[model samples]
Target: MRLRLRRFRPRTGPHEHRVVQPLHPLRHASLRDPDPIGHLLADHDGLNRLAGLFSFAAYSRHTVVHIPLRDGVPPDEGMGELVDLVLVHHSYGLRPSQWPGLRRRLTHGTPLTVRTDEARTARDAAAWQARAHRADRRDELRHTTHARTFFLFGSRDVFAEAADSFAYAAGNGPLHKRVQQGDLALVSAIPGLRQPPGGGHPFEVLICFKPYPPYAHFKRPGR
Candidate 1:
């Protein structure tokens, strides 16, 4: 995710509501793997090399690992081989309904990350549908308290840029103001750095980079 940081310039209407916070990854370049992951997934939250957070529910089977980018880089800072499994957060994997076609394209063993338990509940589904504007079943990935995402990247530049933009804008200052208020637009593949499309109308550009896992993501001590 690479975002060129810019303040959202209001282009229409009066009573412009400006968000005084750094909206992070919006309108940023994304680096999708450009391929689909078939059912080869074993661990739902497979680790990746970047830098971010991970959580264990204290008493649950699910653990969430966040691999956020700071800003867009030169386009090859974080490129990895296309893995057999994809950790789909927010539809990060091929859609289940569309999985058969995806299976045909890639190797078998891919699995989608249905991030939430509420994905099974109708009440949560309805509310999620009302609040989201994503692909058909993206909300299913928000099952846990953490709404992190995972996607195959095309280039490292996108990741590097996202990191740079977010780091510059997220601090408590002018940029953070608009960001916190939500009067800004974001559009980044990394989510934390997303700025809305054509968001120059009242929404400020609070560029921010989402975090990724450390370079030694799977370097759990001893192994």
Candidate 2:
């Protein structure tokens, strides 16, 4: 993706200042032979299969797929053939009956910010360590924990900017503050029992926004 520099002003601060930041263009990966999951997310038949798997807990409800942008393409400027469907499982903190209302509000689009700081990282590490001691659902926990770390820290810059932008738009309120309390999850596709016959894994990397406290299953033992 072409890196474009734009001047951005802070929306919530004592003093407004202009900063030139690079806007990263994001797009879906190719849906060709090598990437079966891409094809799965792009077609109706595949979505039906995915829905079935979700019903069986094959995937998490908080999942959101991400794909690298095509090189040299601007986000607003069309992606041409690289454009494809993305699955966003935004079932966190809501009942099945409430999904329709949320969907309607997000029909056009919404800003999603991922924020991480020293405190947030420490909390995540503590949570991971807590999960490590448990034997229940060990394999699933291990995969998700490792994948979450890899995706978040590996692309730290991108996420940082995203968080800043979100804060600017939505205000840094209590709602946004929960992100620092360990509400994010990343589940990347890996080779596992769920692999399809065509080769690639049946799922894409998922960025999940989970509920806080009692609703969230993964938490430190005492808390």
Candidate 3:
């Protein structure tokens, strides 16, 4: 199925801060379309399609996906750009049912209370670190000598800032620090939407400059 792109502008209000309930597992599964990962792994065409979506969101400044905090409250404004990019990158892995709600939250605004506490935040940060390590290991095994490094961030502001830094470093940095041609400086932001090893997040962002040959396919018109 072709993925449709839409602009999202979330609304926020003081009284909208109530926690939204989670959906039942079977019901949730029923709402999702077939996993796009299968298509992505199938060939470069699939990968390029995904890259197109990313370019669209980045250039258009559209928040195509929304990942609420654990309590269903939207992430702060500091997370706007990074959050949109991260979620769009991972949208192929999300359920269709989840998309509607996420989009609604983004468009309608879910100002309901921010339920995160210090302990929860710390735990989430640690979990994010562990996930980043795993991603590092995977890259190492896949690329061997060419494996890229993972940069982890706990704060939303820093994570958002790193997006720009990565872009600059990827294209114009010194040889040792720059991302090589055909590779991408990518960001992985986890919302902990799935269960166990996958779900629950301190909503951390992890950036890496890694091999991605399809990078040339989705460049903006003039650039």
Error of 3 at 108 (Å): 14
The TM-scores of all predictions, comma-separated, are: 0.20, 0.24, 0.23
Highest TM-score against the true fold, candidate: 2
TM-score of 2: 0.24
Q: Write the residue-wise lDDT of candidate 2 on 45-149 in tens digits.
A: 222222222221212234323222223222221122333222223233222333233323322333333222434433433444454445562222111111111
Model 3 clashing residue pairs (backbone): 10-106, 11-109, 16-112, 17-112, 17-113, 18-112, 192-199, 192-200
lDDT of 3 by residue, 66-114 (tens): 2221221222212221111122222123323333344456433332221
Once fitted onto the true fold, the runs of candidate 2 whose alpha carbons sit more than 4 angstroms away are 1-25, 28-92, 107-115, 136-223
**Between the candidate structures 1 and 2, which one is better when assessed by lDDT?**
2
Order the candidates by TM-score, highest first. Answer: 2, 3, 1
* Model 3 lDDT-worst window of ten: 139-148
List all candidate RMSDs to the true structure. 20.8, 19.5, 16.3
